[model samples]
Target: MKGLFKSKPRTPVDMVRQTRDLLIYADRSPDSRESKREEKMAELCKNIRELKSILYGNSESEPVSEACAQLTQEFFRENTLRLLITCLPKLNLEARKDATQVVANLQRQQVHSRLIASDYLEANLDLMDILIAGYENTDMALHYGAMLRECIRHQTVARHVLESEHMKKFYDYIQLPNFDIAADAAATFKELLTRHKSTVAEFLSKNYDWFFAEYNSKLLESTNYITRRQAIKV
Candidate 1:
């Protein structure tokens, strides 16, 4: 009877909506670095962390709450993924890291639970493309690059990214002027090539002649010591 008098927990939908609003506000606010904005950003990070905990806290022995899974499904249903991607480039470093962590967490969640559908990817193919284009924005490169790696963990996503024409852009990305951007791109490049060995093997066998030639000339021979080191390591 006492439980009836207790306050109910906020729904995952409400929590996600609040976090999304905060992020959008932070992005558009001119004085984003102001104390109030910073406070909101901190709250946003806390919300994501809490969502992660809720979605992933259960042990294999314990069944996860339907509410948690519903929240995750709602996150995609609301097209909140687009919100995260749009705000990523504008977020401060710590905020961006937290956001990326949330994305990675959500990606892993689908693997453990069937509540979130794989068809979500098919519906949001543009989100994957946006992540790929993220490299074009130096400020966003690392954050989105991290998200991309997590996204490709799924076999379906890995195959799509592997086969996309965008795969060719890695050669240019690996040689970008900024060390951090170039390095992050190279890391994603390596993951794409090595994560699914069978898939990569087939890709290489099919594209062998020009792929290695371009890789050798563009990355291996680059004047940047980091690029050279990375290419040789690959």
Candidate 2:
């Protein structure tokens, strides 16, 4: 009889839905109520960790591909990604890291052999702008910047970013006062310019004059030693 009251096991779809619900709550929750928000944030973090473990598996078991597919499909199908990005600042450090990894891994998940995350991102390019702008926010820079780099692994998204006005911002982003942020920005900068050779070539060719001018001046001759080194390497 006691076994009849046991909680039902959650499927991957159930996990995705629950995680999305928590993320929405976080996004809408007011910081005025710090204690309650903290409690919800902790729950959100646990859900995110559970999602990660389902996709990546734990030490005791390997990730189930079907579960990963379901999670990925639901994640991109709904507003989960957007909510996570917007609510990131409200989360604790560990939660932010888990969320970041979740974002990064989903970029590679395939649904029915199609890269659906790319499709979702292509339809939601404005999110990229928010991510790029994050470089200016010291606290959110690294996390958003990492997710931004992963998003560009999709050629369409990379092309959008390359053509956007944000391309010019990386020159300063890579030299930000925070070493970790600066370095992460630099890595993202390199990934953008090198990832899809054809798209990058086309962009560079069209914007060669202004782009190279900024590259040679701001990055090559920047006051920061790491900036100069990275510029030369890239």
Candidate 3:
């Protein structure tokens, strides 16, 4: 009788939908009263923490596979990932950490033995553009850079970025005065070149002269000690 009266447990899909709704709400400009805005942000953070717990099990228990599948399926179904990424900057530091973890974990999550995150990313490739551009935003670079690194884990995603115009910017990004962002950018640049040897070889073969010209002039010949040290990795 007590069990019958209890509220039905929220399904993983329900949780994702709830999170999406909050994200949509937060995505708008702040016209609401300050307290209400704070309340909404608090709710959003709680929801993200719950999402993290679902993807990565909490201390109390390991994650259940079925729930994870449902959550992951619902996650990439629409523009949810895009919403999360664009709205990430508005979130508090703790919320940003939770969302970043959720994103990084999702990139590895398999749905029906398939990496659906990769497929979603393939269709919404522009999200990679936004993330790559994060290297230029001081406040967002690390968060966006972290997510971007996880995203390029897919060879298709890696190839898209390797071939995109963003490749040209990594020269300056790897030399930013902020060592952490520079290092992160360097890691991502190295991964883009080294991850899929075949794709990288083909890209380099075609753009070899131009790419190395910039590499030598921009990185190898840079004034910064850190930049010169990173240039040696190439």
- lDDT: which candidate is best? 3
Better of 1 and 2 by lDDT: 2
By the lDDT metric, which is better: model 2 or model 3?
A: 3
Q: What is the lDDT of candidate 2?
A: 0.91
How good is model 2 by TM-score? 0.96
TM-score sort, best first: 2, 3, 1
Q: Candidate 1 lDDT (Cα, whole model)? A: 0.78
Model 3 steric clash pairs: none
| lDDT of each residue in 1-234, candidate 1, tens digit only | 998899877787788888778767866786656788778877877777766666656454343666566667777777677787887766667767877877887775553446253557666766788898989987888889999998877667777887888888989988888988888988998898889888898888888988989998988888888889978877
Single out the weakest 10-residue window by summed lDDT for candidate 3: 28-37
Residue pairs that clash (backbone atoms under 3 angstroms), model 2: none
> For candidate 3, lDDT tens digit of each residue in 1-234?
888899988888998999899889899847988998899889989999999999899999998888888999999997889999999989999999999999999999999999999999999999998999999999889999999989988989998998899999999899898999999899889889888899999999989999999999999998888898988885
- Please write out the lDDT profile of model 2 over residues 126-178, one tens digit for every residue: 99999999999988998999999999999999999999999999998888888
